[model samples]
Target: MTTRTLTPETSNTFTSTIGGYTVRGRAHSLSAWFVLSLRLMMGWAFAYSGLTKLLAAEPFSAGGYLTHVAAANGNPLAGTFAWMGSTPWFVEFANVAVLWGELFIGLGLLVGAFVRLAAFFGAFMMLMFYFGNWSIEHGVINGDFAYMLVFLAVAAFGAGRILGLDTYIENYEVGGRTLVERYPALEYVLG
Candidate 1:
């Protein structure tokens, strides 16, 4: 068997190149398109989830979802609301967070408003879901964690600025001009 290694010249930067070609950098159109696609997909996912949870539609019982999470923690809505398995107050809080978080994330992505921030919330909610389920089997495997990982790409890349609301926000004449002009995350996302 032969081994091929992919290495970066400068570890400080997120840039990567190959044989005088920019394997991941300097491609504006490509990057923007990728970000746009991700935003839409993630948005729809959240919207669907929020609608179901908020409406308690068929197959989506807020109570059932809460019970599932609680069960993972070895307790079932029989203990404390805040404690994976107790009070109704905790259940209510989680439901609200999940519902709103999803709706906002979906809407924001579609309109490209605070896209990265919305993605952040989506990721956080996904993490909660992943952890709750994992706890059920004591670190056992679950697929939901993979879905949560999708946001990692969005947040780390911060692609919304590419043909996104950031294009305008980046140039806004606000108190802080440095952040707008620099476009820090551009390097990683662009590459």
Candidate 2:
């Protein structure tokens, strides 16, 4: 049998078989799959929740939720939601905003579009949900906290560029300055 020596170029890659399928490529880090899973799961959750609220059989209103929050004695944000519920115009605005926000966040993550922006908003929204009358009796922390961290991670890693539209947008330059150059701070937050 003859053996071949791998050069530097060839050394960069390796092959492995799993479930009888041969996979050949550069090594994949755990973070790659972790981000992908987070994106899909978070995206699906927000999209499904938003769609349900939007297409509910009965007319959906934020007033009821806000009103309930207003009555939640142990919830720190009860007063805030209560005040919001007290204002008809603000209530209407919030109702539309929350539903649309969820839908947009989901779409952004799923399609890997404007992921940084989406994740920023998603983090804050999750924070609001967590503090917005969630019963302390249930637990001090909950799923929203976990989701918030995932959103932050996505933003920090610019995870969208992996398999999303951000990959295309990342290379676009305007007036001799790439988008990242113009918004250097965004480099860490977006691709």
Candidate 3:
């Protein structure tokens, strides 16, 4: 996660062009191929999950899933799940959020559009899933933990800069000032 000035002789650097405006930046140790692979893997996993759920019976219903959580024996969060299930509005909202959130995050990651932002939200959603799905019957650490870590890694490493649209957007200039230069705080999400 080092930022070095783009030099003509810089190795491992990438050049991006949009609307005849070309910009160059150092891709650093993160190889474009590697990031693309991770993007596809993580993106497909999420997208597939959402698609299957959408195609499944009662795609928008959280009742069955929440009821299962509530009925699961020895689940510490059973009461909370039951309460959530009792409220139709909350369950409906959660159902829609989960459905669209997964779809958007997956597409964003795959296309390398708004990658850092997507990873941030992806990590947040994963955290929620981890907590909500926690069960005594299953081990404490699960795939959600691994997925969350991957999302965080993608965000921290600026994986989108290698092979994604972010590479161009990151260096996009308006009035001779790039977004990152204009707003230093945007470095976190823009990267």
Candidate topping lDDT: 2
- Residues 1-191 of candidate 1 have per-residue lDDT tens digits of 37656445432235656788664434443565776687778878888767766677443325565555555466443243235334577666666676787887877766666766777777787777665554546344455566677776776666576556755665566555644446666433321
Which residue window of length 10 is worst by lDDT in model 1? 76-85
How many clashes in each structure?
6, 0, 0
lDDT of 2 at 54: 88
Prediction 1 TM-score vs. true:
0.63
Local distance difference test, per candidate? Answer: 0.62, 0.80, 0.78
What are the per-residue Cα lDDT tens digits for candidate 3 across 1-191? 47778655787666879999999877646565776777778888888877877888865677777767545656577788787777889889889988888888888888787888889989998876676677545567788777899898788668777577887887889789987877777777755
Q: Please list the residue runs of candidate 2 whose C-alpha ends up more than 4 Å from where it truly belongs after superposition.
A: 1-28, 183-189
Order the candidates by lDDT, highest first: 2, 3, 1
| TM-score, one value per model | 0.63, 0.77, 0.74
Instruction: Give candidate 3's error at residue 171 in angstroms.
Output: 1.1
What TM-score does candidate 2 reach?
0.77
Candidates ranked by TM-score: 2, 3, 1
